[model samples]
Target: MKELAHLNKYFFKYKFYLFWGIVFTLISNLFGIVPAQVVRHALEMVKANIALYFLFENSSLQVSSYKIITFSIAVFGVLILAMAILKGIFLFAVRQTLIVMSRHIEYDLKNEIYAHYQTLPLSFYKKNSTGDLMARISEDVSKVRMYIGPSLMYLINMVILVFLVLSYMFSVNARLTWFVLIPMPILSLSIFLVSSIINKKSEKIQKSLSNLSTFVQEAFSGIRIIKSFAKEEKFVETFTKESENYRKESLSLTKVDALFSPAISFLIGLSTVICVYVGGQEIIAGKITAGNITEFIMYVFMLTWPLTALGWTSGQIQRAAASQKRINEFLKIRTDIISSENKNQDLQGKISFQNVSFTYPDTGIKALKNISFDIKEGESIAIIGSTGSGKSTIANLLFRMYDADEGKILFDDTDIKALNISNFRNQLAYVPQDVFLFSETIRNNIKFGINGVADSEIYESAKKAEIYNNIMDFEEGFDTKIGERGITLSGGQKQRISIARAIIRNPKILVLDDCLSAVDTNTENAILNNLREIMKDKTTFLISHRVSNARLADKIIVLDDGKIVEQGTHEELLATAGMYRDLYEKQSYSETVPS
Candidate 1:
């Protein structure tokens, strides 16, 4: 209910459009009831004609009676055409207003969700499935639109139309109105039961659809791995299973949804049969005129459609309500990275940690335990360890991707939590182990986030990363479009482009997470040399396992099982004859024995 109510803000903004829409609906209905009134008048006129003919069988003026009836019908026909036209015009206005309201809600919800997504820490994405997130943004939002534009409007119309139509009938004949409304309770009870079933089935259907999306996304993303292992048949079998499940659930939901309208309508139809039976008897018994019967029956039948709408509108509300619940769950996730209210402050390269500790939200064990370190401006450092030894965790902390569970990280002794996260991260540039490039030109990828950088700056950054020559060799040069994640480029080439992007930012701090593992030793050496020339003033944290990569850093640190075991210069560490020296010997020994 809270999530659905969030849309009320948008409705308030566009209330004037809604007001006019309702005004026109009233106008349309006013004209609509005109036909029902004319129907009653027609019955009166026909009865009068019958009496005149029966009583004055030989009257010469009977020709005038025929003329009077014909003229009355022609006038009714013109009035009906006019009513229909006005009704159509008002219907269009109502539909357009609903569309505008739906679109406004979509815009506001999309922006809110997207903005929330941006604020979430990296751990959130790691925990949540990408397929589920995409479903929220697309499928969930569309459900909200269905609720706002049609379901909600239908509800409003249902209330107004029922009240007004019932009031009119009651005024005409209280006894007859009581007979017509006999099925009203049965109709309400039926709709209530169906609506409960619809909510449960709709929730199941959405969950099934979410799984289907997950299967499709994962299957395509890992298609290469599946093919390499010859698992096409397995994937096909899996897809069939998921698709069949989705199909069954969707069919069940449709069946449940489809049963509602007819059930409501059946009860309403029962009332119609009674009206016809009772009304006919009354007229034949001379208790009421035929014109009165005609008016009452027309109004009684009019209640059927609105009653029927109540069922489907309930289902739509349930689906949208489920979607709204999902959306609110997403919005309610607290941003792990705390940001400052003032966001315009600049950052320098100096960073320090004091008695810092962190454990993932759901885990008892810590990723980084009681770790404390500091790096001055223009200092170069390397962090090396086995996989999952918390080497990258240090990089995560430096950028405040995840705040430390205990103590504080600081920028030159100022608490990192006190500074604006966006401004703080803007000061640092990181190139991760997995390189992600947009499906765009090499130049554009390098120039992302900032605009109007000169060609020379792009060339310089590419040259520093040792990718300039390869980019120039392409037929389209730097302008060539790189496929998604730079699929067109080799692994080594992709790493270099990622490097170029970081270097181009010319940030205060540079962090690389095993960025050069793909490139050959010769290219690695050249790239390192270029980085030395370009990164003189920039503070750097280099994460790697290879001794050659770590040797370039001014200071070296070794982590083992989330604890810092040793820290010193390369020569100092080698002289100490600790883990770094032993690891170096093992790597060097392997090089000589390799094929």
Candidate 2:
């Protein structure tokens, strides 16, 4: 209940529907009890008419008495039928209000969670699996919905029916009513014990489901790798193991849930037996009639379904609480990267990293150590480093994907943190070392960076990336749909398409982090030539290992083991015997002796 308290606002938001639902439930139950009373009256009337018929036996009054009895019974039948019809109508209204409110709340909740996911820092994603996130939003929300809709509706209906039925039963004979209620305390104790076990098992089942979902998602996402390595059997075996575990957890829950109906039915049956026995004794003692016994039995049976549903509703509440607790865990998370609300500032592309230092939060490894560099407006600087030399970290810092743990980064002589994060990012284009494209057409992928882009702009960007000819070679040209993450395209094609996406943005600053690694030297040179013209009077940061790419930059910064070892023009770096020269000589020799 404490965990589910988060939904109070939503309940208040749709209070109108909730109010009507409760009113309708009360009216339906009121009508529902009328049929039981009608049955009791009919039985009493038959008993009285039987005596009258016997007294008028073999006389003219006997026929009149029979006719009166027939008419009276027919009238009672119509009254009972009317009560049933009215009850059904009110029941329909109850569902229309409460069920609809539950649906509305579900919609608002899902959108809220998804929007929150978008605002969370990248580190949050690193800490959580995609499947667990999906489970919380999809599976957990659905469980909560069950609590809000069917479980809640039945609970209200049961409570109202019990009050109405019990009040009438006690009015008729308090002693009989007390005898009928003897099994209630035992039933309650059973429910409390079973409910605790259900709560614990429900949480375990949900966790198992999350693990199963995570495994399936990873398997599908990496299906290509599995097939290539011929590990299909291994994957199938692993999937089976996960599935078996999920099944076992579910069965365990079902075993506990199985106790609910039988226990409720047995207690309700005991109440009915008590009613019959006590009513007979009352009749013999001249305190009640046979019709009273019949009515009491009807009341006990009337409560049977609600008592059974009580068990189910309790289980639902426990499950919803478990799921809501999971949801609250994510909703309570606060993102570390809070964006400033200043969107009016403009970028001039003069960037400086003043003694910037950073460490990867997840791994606790220092990726950058007292790194300092500067880039003037309209200048191109290439950062050359070996693997793990922290080249990509520089690009991440520039984009503000992460903030430096120490020192300051400035853009146009202003602290980067002070600028509007959205506006600052909108002015920059970044092509990461690992490219990702959606399952969209090539044209749409090129136009992804900005909305309302013209087809001519898409074609121009594609041409600049040297991918226009390859796109035209396809049957659908730019309209060809790339599969998930551009799996249908070659590695070079995917990289070129990603490059076109960045190029189409026409940003003031461009960060290409080893984007041309897959393309041939000829294509690379062609794209670089186009960039030379486009990047005129714009800041460009080319992060790569190749000296061929670095030589064209105005300045080259060589990094070794997370520290800047050298910085100079290409000719000056080649003149000196440093890490940059050693890398250049090695790459040159490797290129000459290639297979």
Candidate 3:
């Protein structure tokens, strides 16, 4: 009930339409009662005329009096036809108003969910899969829409119908109404029991579906790796197993859902049998007219549809509750990263790690331990380390992707935690090792970091990153659409384009995390030369294992086992005859002796 109440805010947002929709539904239901009453009155009139004919069987005048019956029938016929037309009109209004409102509400809710996703921190995404989030947004949200729209509309109509029909039934024969209603309590109990089971089963079914979606998404995303490894059969078997589980869970829910309608129908059938038996005895006892019993039977049949629909509506409500719970689980989680209430302050190029130590969530090992370094404005520093030596972790901290587990990081001699996250990040640009490009034109990818950039700026940035010539070689040049993840371009081209994207912003601080590893040595040297010119007025952190690249920085830092072991100029490190010098010699030997 609490979940349902929370959902009503969406319905109430379009109260104008909902108000008119309810009014129209009430009018339509009122029209429905008229036709049944007209039929009863017409039957009563016929019974009386037949009796009069029998009393005066020999008189022609008596037979002439029956002509008035023809006019009476015609009047009732016209009333029924008019009522049917009015009912149709009101029904159309109800659908247009209420049903259309649901569609609008669905649009708003989808946007809200997506907007919330954009605000979530990287750690949230790390713990959740794309498929599970997609299922919640698309599949689960759609189920909630069903509950708000057709199910609620029909449920409200049923309530109105039962009330009006029951009132008339009691007016005609109170005793008979009591007998026919014997099954109502039992029907309600059955629906309540079955609906709870359906709710639980629906949750399991949604979860299984999310798992299946995740598997398919991962398979498609990693198709290249799977095909290269020749694991097609293995993947196919795994997908088949997941598909079977989804089917099994769905069928289990269906089994319980199918019981609702028939169980309600069986109870309704019993009410009909009792109505006919008791009402007939009343007629014979002269306690009621034949028309009264006839009307009572008709009302019982009129009650049949809403009673059965009640069962289905109950299941819909329960399924929506389960879906809401699933969606709220993610929506309710507060991100680990949030901005301080302090006023927005622009970051300068100066950066400092004051005894910073950090560990990733759910992992016991520290990625960075007591790391203290100062990077001055407009200076270039190279962070050299082997894999898992916390090189990227340093870049991540500068980018504010994660805060230090202990100690503080400063921007321009002020604690970075005091600045708004958006304003803090606005001063920096990053080119990560794993470059990702959208399936868009080359021009769009280059300009993705900033809004309202000019074509000349884009071209100049591409030229500086040494990718302009390669881009121009294509028939459409910058206008050509790159396939997913820039698959149409070579690794070297993708990395250079990514570089161009970063440089286009002309940030105060730049962090390049081994982004040049994919390019050839000659291209790497050319790009590095261009980068030095661009780095003249900006603070830069160059993360790489290539000594040739590190040699260009003013200062070099060597990391081993999450600790800084060496820090000096490139020449000073070599003079120490330490880890930096040994790594440089080994890399030089590998390059000279390579296949």
Residue 401 in model 3: shift from native, Å?
1.6
lDDT of each: 0.83, 0.91, 0.88
Per-model TM-score on C-alpha atoms: 0.96, 0.97, 0.96
Please identify model 2 stretches exceeding 4 Å from their true place: 58-60, 340-343
Q: What total of clashing residue pairs does each candidate reach?
A: 0, 0, 0
Instruction: Write down the RMSD of all candidates, one decimal each.
Output: 1.9, 1.6, 1.9
Q: Write the per-residue lDDT of candidate 1 for residues 459-554, one digit (tens) a residue.
A: 999999999999999999999998766877899999999999999999988999999999987999999998887678888989998887888888
TM-score of 3: 0.96
TM-score of 1: 0.96
Error of 3 at 154 (Å): 1.4
> lDDT tens digits, residues 1-595, model 2?
9999999999999999999999999999998888888888999999989999999999999999999999999999999999999999999999999999999999999998999998787778988999999999999999999999999999999898999999998899999999999999998899899999989999998999999999999988888999999999998999899999999989999999999888888888888888888889999999998988988888898899889999999999999999999999999998877655455577888999999999999889899999998999989999999999999999989988888999999899988888887788899998999999999999988898588998999999999999999999999999999998898998899999999999899888999999999999899999889888878888999999888888768999999889999999999999999988999999999989969
Name the weakest run of 10 consecutive residues (lDDT summed) in model 3.
Answer: 339-348
Q: What digit string (tens of lDDT, one per residue) describes model 3 on residues 1-595?
A: 5665656777778999889988998899999887888988998998878787667777986677577677788999999999999999999999999889888888887888898898887778878999999999999889888888888899889988888888888887789899999999988888888988999898998999999999999998788889999999999999999999999998998899889778877887898889889989988888887777777777777778887778778888888888888888887887767767654776667888889899888566799989998889888999999999999989888877888999899888888777788877877889998899999999999999588999999999999889999999999999999988897899889999999999998999999999999999889989999998999889999999888889879899999889999999998999998999999999999889958
Ranking by lDDT: 2, 3, 1
Off by over 4 Å in 3: 53-66
Worst 10 residues of 2 by lDDT: 336-345
Descending-TM-score candidate ranking? 2, 3, 1
